[model samples]
Target: MNATTVLRAVGGLLALSLSQQLAAQEVPPSLAELSLEALSNTKVTSVSKRSELLTDAAASVYVITSEAIRRSGYATLPEALRLAPNLQVARVDARNYAITARGFNSAFENKLLVLIDGRSVYTPLFSGVFWDAQDVILEDIERVEVISGPGGTLWGANAVNGVINIITKAAGATQGVLAAASVNGDQRVGTIRFGGRIGKGRFRAYTKTLTLDDLQRESGAVSLTGMQRSQVGARADWERPDGASTLQGDAYTGALHQQGTADIKIAGANLLARHTVRISGGTELSAQAYWDFTERNQPNAFIEHLNTVEAQAQAATLLGASHRLVVGAGYRHAFDRLQNGVGFGFLPAKLDMHWGNIFVQNEFDLTPEVRLIGGAKLEHNNYTGWEFLPTLRLAWNPTASSLLWSAASRTVRAPSRIDRDFYSPSNPPLVGGERRYNIAGGPNFQSEVAVVAELGYRLNLLSDFTYSATAFYSIYDRLRTLEPNQAGAGSVFLNRASGRTKGVEMWADWRVTPALRMSAGAVAQQVRTRLDPDSRDASGTTGLATGDPSSYWKLRTAYDIALGHSIDLLVRHYGKLTRPAVPAYTTADVNYLWRIYPNLELSLSGTNLFEARHAEYGGAPNRTLSGRAVGMKLLWQPK
Candidate 1:
């Protein structure tokens, strides 16, 4: 069915349901009701592996609250991420995104680590996430904590640049029925969920579907085909006075059209279980395990089937009056089978990979106003035998509403299958009297490494305004490069490049009035690299990685017009890219929401209102242009 037809059907169903639930209900408390001081004190766990106030964390972090998600009118996770100034996000197509922090950004960005409820989502093949395959009910997310620096000491390899932790609300807190539908131009989305009690535990199940129309090229011709996806998920939680446990699972499938080619197909499923308990000496212990399966088929390109299993456990305890310690260990195994296409392939066709790591962190109080944090991790992988990651941090609070912090760390991006086993032309055929492949795997590839230092400050003034600023510098070595082989027949992956990066990130929030809030954020950075004297790279040293913007900024405002009405506006500007030469662009978005009834809401939103169409990434003819879009949504949550 077309997007319009599906949208109309879903809209009609929601309207019919809404009519029966017209009674007024009590509105739940929202983030806007919290004072700036209270918001700055939000609890976060990604930085230290333990709950701590956001203002006390020693990392450059940003939290996207649930209320922010609802006010932004973003239907996808990638879109919602644009709110974080520390991140650089670009849409490559209808289903693909290039996201990163500091530097080194690409559709297959390998330096960032992402988690959904503590489950790693990066594929072992390239140590990168397939954004198209990741999704969740936006309304169910408690908060998204984004840390824009190395977290390898705790998260292990691939956390060289940043980490994103998506935390969801417990089923017990979402006990009700929710149905929502949205239509934007030729795109449509629909979701239905139910939550209730099962014995002493709470359970929730949901189904979501989305369809997007084809995108146009600079010439106004269809460049990338449209796509459709469907997903179903469930979660259950049990809590006791001293501990809690959770079990959740998800299954999804999607299809995308390709001009003059067969449709691309994808499907995946995952199951996870987590438990936490209080132990002796006022200690806390937590454990989790998960299994995941994924399948993908791209006609004339390649097909793959992968299975992964992982388990981890951690404990937090107070060693003495001045010291707090956290220790953790994890293990992961992945098995995959690939069917090579004529264009490219991964050698061996089928392979098994293993990874294991153990980490320990200690927080020592130096005085009433100062503290020291240190941690280290020893990780083992199939390709790179063993790698060590370590970090140190110092934080001081001169006043209750102000903080100063500094940190230094060493991290690495371990070799993936692509770095050591990739090959172009699965089976090379004789061409122009040559039977050799164009690209061959690197037999002696090693992990890329980086040493970084950062300084930051945070302040909350008069309980009405809050601001955070961070400055960082990094030196990188053993970076990836494609060097010509001795035989001069093909190129192989190597680590012969070095570079440095320096940047600043800042953001602030202000309550302009009792009903109005304003926020602003910006980031600026520079990257420089050089190749070894003996290195003969086919592409320039900088070509190995994707292009990056030198700077970007965003501004947002939210206003509550009345008891049940609100409006939000956002504006963002991105710096130009140098490699492929994409021009800079600015976009503006606005949303208005009305709570018709206590349990029912209607919203109207417009995206890219300032421009008719623009390009965010990629070069000329093939680059897709995003046009202005408007959407309407209806949500019903029975209390």
Candidate 2:
């Protein structure tokens, strides 16, 4: 069907839902049963890789529950992340997202790691993520765990910046048919789901799809590069008095056919099983196994296809009433086959790669108010042989309403397939040789490692207010860089330099009443890199220095209206970037949502709300990295 037809149909459904809500508003729920204190004290898991009360956790963490998602009216995962503090969200074009935590934001941001129910989503080809290819039914998500800072001791590679864990609800929580659709300026999204109980377990399945309008050019002209995506997922759970276990999986099959541009199609899947056992010794043992795969193809791009596979197993046990121990290992094997074409070189041979790691951690409670945590991980990979990572943490609970914490950790980021073994053509013809010379990949590149120290405090200020603040300093060694070689236009990846990154994050929340809430967050960071004593900058200089402004802030306000209704407003501001070639500019966004009914909702959101002419990063004169985009959506669930 055409876009217009689909939109009209969705509009009709939304009208009916709104009418139903208006008819039911006469009888609102009692105010005594709901209050603000209860919402701010909710528990979360992303901070420690385990569940804990938000007020009691040591690290900085944020929780956006299912209700929050519904009330915000966001149509996609990336859209929702804009509400988070310390997060940098930017659109680099028609099909790229520049998202990061603290700093180092880019289209293929490598500092941060994202997961859906314990499943890692990083790609082996670029050592980054393709946000456009990742989608989920927002309604099915129980909560989003956002942690700022290193999660290496627990999460492994690419956890240098932070971790975003998208946790979905179990089958039992959603027990009926649900259908939702949304429309706005240039994007449309729809979702459907069903849930029920089986013989011995509960099972639920869902599908989400989206079609985005073409991106706008600097002249306000559309790029004719729009894309479409679809995703399907399911979850099952079993619980008897004896214990509880759960199994979950998802499959994403979609085509990114851009008009008049190179089209790429991808298919992927993820599966996981978790088991928890309570022992007579008062210790709990838990284990989980997970795997993810992705296959992609871009007919026009020289680098034609990439297939990746990742699998992992982890186990944890409580050693005593005050000590918790964890140990587990896993492996990742990726195979890449490429074809040569314009601006690209052929892969003389296919590449086979493997990554393995094992880790352990101990949490000790020294006193009723003080606790300590320590851990380490050993990793082996094709490029880097044996490597070790260690960490230590100290936490103090002054009262039931506040916590102070500090941590020290060392971790590494291994090379990708392209970094260790791949070839490419040169851009802007080299000083010598043919118009293009293949870039060289090395098998001797050392892993990127860093030592990070952090301190933070969390406080429950008043009956309806909460706040968290954190500061960190990191020293990086063995950074990878490329230099022109004698092999015509050839460049190699090697351990070339050292750098330092320091930053602070602060967030505050205030509940004006049971129906009104407000939140604000901000980040200030700086990074500086210098060429090694024996190394040379791209310009042949002995030293070159640079850093991005890395400063940004966000504000949000929400109200829960009568009769199961709510509305939210959000505004985000990005600071002017000033380093590594300044194309700096600031921008803002506005978003709103309305819960038309308990089982239905509608949302309207837009980025670059003022159509600000700004550049978050990159320095291409013709770069259309800044603009405005608006969208809407509808969600429905029948009891």
Candidate 3:
């Protein structure tokens, strides 16, 4: 359908507080003030692998609350990430995104790590996320914790750039029926959730679906981007005096349009269980385990099936009341199988791989106002053996509302299946020559490594105004490159590239009144890369840099008129991209919501308001600029 035709059929559509100190209050607070109260009180779990105040986090971090998600009318995780202005998020297609931290944004960027609860979403097949498959019910999300710098020491490999931790609400918190539905020019989405008591534990279940139309081609024709997905999940949690346990799982199926047909099909399911023990002497222990199964089929292209299982445990304890020690270890095994096409295939059609890692971190109290944190992680995998990541952080609190911190870390991005044993027939062999072209995997490809240093400042300008700024520098080595084989016969993946990236991010939040809040963020980075000298390799190797934007700035304003009614607006601008040259663009997103009844809500939201459409990345088969969009939503819940 055309743009006018689609809009005629339906219309659409559719912030966070970080607080420093939360003193106890005698009486209860109102719903409207809960966010502000929690912003100052919300403890974050991603920064240090332990619960700590948001203002005390040594890294450049931000949190997106569920209320913010509902107010902004964000239907997807990627769209929700836009609230964190520090991230470089670009729409590649109707269902694809190029997301990264600092720089180095690409279709398969490996420097960033993403997780849901504690499950890694980065695929081992390509070391990148399949955004289409990383779906979750937006309404069930409790918060998203984002760190803009290295987290390898606490997380693991592929955390060289940043880390995103998606945390869901406890089953007990979602104790009623909740449903939401929305429609726009390009898509329709619906979600339903129910929660209640089951035996001695709380249980919840949710189902969601989305149907998307083809992205509008620059030619005004519909591109082959239509897609559909259905997902369902459930969770159960139990608590006692000394312990708590949780079990959750999800399954989903999806289809994507391709070559005039919705031939790409995908399905997956996963189950996880975790238990926490509140030990005496100010100590805590936790254990978790999970298994995942997935499959994908594309007629004539390739077929893939993967199964993975993993387990981990962590313990945190006090050391003489002056030091805090935390330690953890984990193991993972993946059974990966795939059938290759002419141009695509895994060398060993079916293979099994293992990964194991251990990490330890400690926080030392140098004095009443100063703290020093040090940690290290040792990871081993089939592809890269014995990767060591280490980090050190120092923080000083000069006053009750001011913090000074600096950190240094080392991280790595291990090689993936595609980097090894990837064979593609170049062309028809010479009339009488035996297969003139050969490009294969190297038996000795090394992992990519990076060293990063960062310094940041945080303070409360006034009782209601908070500001933060962070500066970081990173050095990379042993990056991926194409190396010629003996006698210039063919090429293999090698490590012969080096680069550097430096950037700064700053943002501020101001609560002008009880119902009005404004926030703004700005980030800038420059990347320089070159091939290592004295190496026999192809000329002009691809550096670690991809289509990275050099500068970004955004502003967000939110105003709430009633308990569940608000108006929000966001304006953003990104610097021009390189190496295919997507022009810089500016856009605004607006949302308005009204609680028509005690348990019913209606919302109107618009995105990409400046022009008909704008391109953020380049060179994808079905690539299309996302046009201006407006949609509406209805949310209902039992009182």
Candidate 4:
């Protein structure tokens, strides 16, 4: 649909809602519920590694609150991420997803960094996340902070494009038993959780399971089989006058079915501990540690057993009346054991990787209304020895409800196993009297780098309206590419590509009434790439890193129909893809909830209501089509 049509639809919906609300006699919504003013004042830590009001944050950040998640009726993390306008999320299969920010979107997108409670989840093999393997109890999540800019200055390497931080609620906040279940034609999910007290501490334990049916291709043929997963986890928190501590752990196992092949199996477990103490001179010291293990076996593909251990510590304090400083250091180690498959594999099979970084950031209060922030990180990795990331930001608060900010930063995506050690044909054989492989990793592969600049503005009108906008431009160098060997052996990975990306992200929230709210978000971006003059890259790797739409927009509305009834509607439009030639499409989703009792609720949700089936990613007959989905959920929470 064109922009005009979308605008008309949104206007019609708004007029209808206003008319209905005007005729109703129900009371206003409770103040305890989320409000536009509350949303603007939401505390976000991803922007500067310190808690601050969302509107005051200089970075292009969006916060997906718990209330939004509960109302959307999304069952998976990737689906929830769609609420962020700056992000591009595509479902690849029954279990896999491709998600990124700005541009350079792909299944193996390496520039975006993701963290769950301060623990990184990207795999060393590709410097990307396995969306299928990463799961969390949606009900336990507090908020998801998404920043659509380089965060490497504080987050370390691989944060070249953006960062997503998934933060969960404290144990004490969930002090009762909660159970939820949802089922649709293609999927089913169930979860049960209980929280109580343990000697001066609060504890919670939960278990969850999900099953999905097979999906069909554009030709109505089954493309991929179903998948299932089961998980159990627990969290405990202790709080004192001066300090707090937390411990959490989770374990999961699952399998994905494949046609004419053995099922792919996956299992993993993680444990994390964190502590924070308020020290003298208003200084706060915090420390975190985590151990993660993952195993995946794809018959005829590959088998991997990976273990990772990481530790980090940071201190935040005021150096003087005008400066706030933060200093930290981190170390991570990974042991990756790979069982080569007949088709391709990482050479040497087993390897050990280490990473370490130290960062320092300071915010100078140049004046009461102005601030300057500067930070840098020195990171060392096994593949790319040492890299530097730095950022400078300036923020000016012209008024109590208006903020203008600008930033410049340098970030990098360090080489992964795929770029340094991968080899096609685990055992190469003689081809035309020459032993050759189709592809080989490059020993000289270097880190991909990006220098980015951003400008943003935020405005709030009273307690009823808020808006945010950010524009960014990035210059990239040493991008990954595939170069043919001089000896005609095969193509090898190399740094032979460069590119530039520019984009704008915008979002707004309007409280039409005390019981009605509306939000709109949109993104427009362009990516341009070129091959180095002396490099001969035959694989068209320049375009391989990006598969994105020129523009996309979404409009959402939430209405409280009655004292215990609410309804939410969302409309999204995506532009066409040039390289893959995917047609443009518009979709609508709706959800309705009824609170039967103070502690019990039921909801019905429908997705892709405007289409029978559509493809969001991939090409041709091989791509899976997402069909219309309708589901009902029951949630119970005991006081």
Candidate 5:
């Protein structure tokens, strides 16, 4: 169906659902209500790259809302991610982080995909995220949707293990000058935002700045390396009541200046626009487009630039009482410009990708107690001509407050510039050469595919307790692998023959009383790769053994007391590995927040609380000690 048709459908559905909810609220019962529960019903879009309820989705999903962000007292996006067990987020240094899901803990973790709003941040230089480049006014975040398994169908490439979507509130959400600042031993951060309406549209603008001191080495002495950054962003939204349509746009730009062991300076910007139209009867259509640009320069005389442009349009409609059909097509174009001091030739390339797919899912309400879901995506990309992904799901609700679900799906991760045409420097100095060389790319590369099966159960045992558990197994094929060249100058990129990834994730939230709450979550994973006998790199080291490990663990817990105060603890453990170099270690962090008043808040938090004093399992010699620092923050909202 067309966008107009979908809009009419969604218009009807929204009227029905809203009216239903209003009727239910007419006779307000004298029950209990908590501030946190007021907004728990907020809609989320990252689960399937579509809107859905937190309780209705079959996959493992967690949300950290703005209120939660305020209550948790976190200073950055990574800090908030620590609360979710399905994510393994660790700080490698003052400006670097090792974040992944299930396993594969490394400085350049390629398995996970991260997005700010709908703009993908994974770099083309390395198939990983430059965490330091992602900066936002934390308080302005509407919600963070974290999905702990492969989301390749909806998100496409690099979403092999998980997807993290950071959604910010529309311009209308903030209508006044809001300011927050924090200061710690080695860190200082500030945020200021102002928003209002213009005629029929709402607009919000914000600016953020941060300065952090370098982390101390394992030797327990103060380090002189530090980082400084500044950022500015703006968002605007317009809703036309006549046709029930919404128009939204956002722009963000930031620059970083750092004096670390390796001096570096970088700047980037992203501009995005989206339009959503509600249809007549439970159908909708949305279109979005974005442009991202990044430029970086290193003191050692290396310079790089990247520009990416993407556009997509999707339509969703109801086939009947039990079926939902969605169709979409997307296009992406990326240009890379690199200037390297190393002996490799200066290579500049452009990559173009186009994908089209249609998915049909059935939410069959069988016998009023059971439901069945079946869907598929027929996708075509430039690298991989055509790909098919199918999913089957069954959900049984034996009781009103509990659900049991099982699902199986096939997903694919398409090739990217980083996988097919990347050239960069490697740390380990060549055994015989003064400077090491590292370049990876493959024109004959193929897309990575996976067959995933999952079993999950969720229960609201009591009004005070809710728990969820999920087990997943994924069979992988054509996985990306890096091999050194026999010429001894760079690395070769190719797909592995076969592999397997399995894991379990569990989480729970309990309200000891109306004023006291506790939450805990954990995830454990095992990954194995079956390499081809002929798979060898220039160094003659098997890529399979140096990749993600066979075991990994992540755990998180938080306690919120009745007196408008809370405390949280997080721990992550990476299992032992022999191929990748480095030993296993557990990193822990602690945070506390105090709500001084309804409009004022204060907090003090410390990460790397355990001070593991170790390095990541990846290839690097930097002694990463847990950052031990205390910080205080203040926030005010004028009514």
Candidate 6:
């Protein structure tokens, strides 16, 4: 159906749901209320496998609270990621995004790891994320925790550059009804949530759809086609006298039209279960398991089917007063099948792989204010036998509001099917004629590794001002490169290059008054690589594929007045990027909300308000937003 048709259908559902609600109910809490909750309980788990304060966390971690998500009107995870100035997010198409942290940003980038709840979303086929395939009910999200550096020692491979953890709210907290819809020209989005209680437990169910408008090329031709997606998900939480458990699952389907390629269709479903039991004082044990099924089909490109199952167990205990310990182990099995196309395909067509890892971490307190942290992980996989990653950290708290910390860690990016089995090429050249060009995988490829070190300082400079600064340096080895084969017939992937990347970033939060709050951040990074004397990089981007945007900055201002009214403003700027040389650009976005009734809120939001059209990524399709846009949403929460 067309966007308008879907809009009508969703509108009908919204009206039906609203008609059953009370005339007036409690208003949704304001930003201040949400921010206060986050500050008191905004836990960071991805950094150390245990929850801790964001400032006390020994990494460049940032949290995007639910209020931030609501005010941004991003509509998608990729768009919302732009809030973290340390991340590099670029739109490649209406439905595709290139996102990374540190550097090495590309549509097919694989150096970043993403998780939803406790489930890893990175695909085994390419060891990268298909941004389009990742979806969630934004309204159900509690916070997005971002760690902008290596986490291999604790989180495993693919955490080379950064780690993103998308955490959803508990079912009990979302008990109510909600509907949000917005219109930006031809782009439209609608999501409905209904939550209630089952016996003594709580449950929530949600369904959402997205439709995007296509952009026009400079020549008046369409650059990219519009896209559509439908998704449904549900979650339930139960707490007994002895233990607590959660069951959640989701299903999604979507279709997309590429500029020149055959249309693509995707569908997937997953179920996850997590259980926790309190053992003793300050001690807990937990178990988690999940199964995921996904399929992607392109008329002429290729078809991929994947089934994954994972199980893990973890424990956290206070080993005496001065020592705390956290330990965990996990096993993952993936069965994937790929059908070749004229474009790219894996050699085996079908494969089964298993991944296993075990980890242990010890937090030792040298004194009341000095702490030493040490951890290590041992992982085994098909491509890489046994990989050991270790980390060392130290933190010194000299005052109640100041912290100084430093860490050193080792990480690796294990090879995937894409690196060792992929093959494809344009039409072959006539007979022996040098073969126009062939791109094949390297059977001898090895896993890429890096050693990273970081230093950080955080302080509350004033009663209302707080800030954090972190600087990192990393050295990479066995980086991927496109090199000629010994036969000189075609090029193959090889580990023949190395490089160094370093950056410094800072974020500040200020509360000017009881009703006004602002947060600002900026980041700068530089990446450089050198090829071996005998190696030649066909794309030339080998030395710079990290596609460093050089720098970026963002500012967010939120002001709340009497009643439930509030205004949020955001200004974001991106620096120039090389490799294709994209000019710098800036965008301004704002959202205004009015609580017409205690149960209903009306919102007006504008995105890309500073430009007619601006490109964020270079090359194919030249993705961009078309003109300034305005939209509205209805946020209804029944008492």
Instruction: Please tell me which predicted candidate would have the highest lDDT against the true structure.
Output: 1
Against the correct fold, how does model 1 do in TM-score?
0.95
User: Which structure is stronger by lDDT: 3 or 5?
Assistant: 3
Candidate 6 residue-pair clash tally: 2
- For candidate 2, write residues 1-639 as lDDT tens digits: 999999999989977977786786643342222454675667876655555678776776777777667666677888777767867877666556778786666666676889888777787665678887787888788888888788777787778778888888877888889998887556788888899988888888988888876665655555555678888888888876555688887887666655466667777777788776666654455667766666676665544345445555555566768877767777767665666555554345466767788888778899999999888888777767777878898999988778999999887777776666555652336565554455666557777787889999988865777888999998888876666654455566666788888989999888777677788998888877766776543642112223346677878877666544555667676666544244445445444555566665566666666554555555445445455666676667765
Candidate 3 wrongly placed segments (more than 4 Å): 1-37, 219-221, 260-262, 426-438, 461-463, 534-546, 562-564, 620-622
lDDT agreement with native, every candidate: 0.89, 0.71, 0.83, 0.88, 0.68, 0.83
Task: Report the lDDT tens digits of candidate 6 across residue range 1-639.
Answer: 899999999889866655454244455567654443246346778888877887677778888878788877677888788887678788765777889888888778889999999899998877889888888988888889988998988889889989999999999989888887877665788989999999889999999999876776544577666678899999999987667999999999988867786668999999999999887678889999999999999777789899999999999889899998999999999999988787667878889988899999999999989899999999999987899889999999989778899999999999998888877753455656664348878889999999999999887654577788999999998889988877667788899888889989899888777678898999888888878677787766474565677788899998887556788888999898876667789988898877665677788888888987777776434445446778888777766
Candidate 2 local Cα displacement, residue 43, angstroms? 3.4
Give the worst 10-residue stretch by lDDT in candidate 6. 32-41
Tell me the spans in candidate 1 whose CA falls farther than 4 Å from its real position: 1-25, 430-435, 544-546
lDDT of 4 by residue, 217-259 (tens): 8877897668899999999999998989999999999998888
lDDT of 4 at 422: 93
Counted clashes in each candidate structure: 0, 3, 13, 0, 18, 2
Range of the 10 consecutive residues with the lowest summed lDDT in candidate 2: 539-548
Q: Give one digit per residue, the lDDT tens place, for model 5 in 493-559.
A: 7874677778788887766665455667766677776677777633423343345444555555556
Q: Please provide, for model 1 over 1-639, each residue's C-alpha lDDT reduced to its tens digit, 9 standing for 90 to 100.
A: 999999999989866654544433455554456678778778999999988899889999999998899988888888899888788998876777889999888777899999999999998778999887899999999999999999999999999999999999999988899999999875788999999999899999999998878888887779666789999999999999889999999999999878789889999999999999987776899999999999999999889999999999999998878889999999999998999999999998999999999999999999989999999999999998999999999999999889999999999999998999898978898767865778887889999999999999999897699999999999999998889877558888999888888999999999988788999999999877788787888675456353788899999999888766789998999898876668999999898987766778888999988889888877886888888999999999977
Off by over 4 Å in 2: 1-37, 219-224, 257-262, 302-313, 340-342, 345-349, 426-438, 486-489, 539-547, 579-598, 604-607, 612-615
Residue 2 miss distance in model 1 (angstroms): 29
Clashing pairs in 4: none
Predictions ranked by lDDT, top down?
A: 1, 4, 3, 6, 2, 5
What's the true lDDT of residue 182 in model 1?
Answer: 95
User: Residue 9 of model 5: what lDDT?
Assistant: 100
TM-score of each: 0.95, 0.88, 0.92, 0.94, 0.83, 0.92
Sliding window of 10 residues with minimal summed lDDT for model 5: 27-36
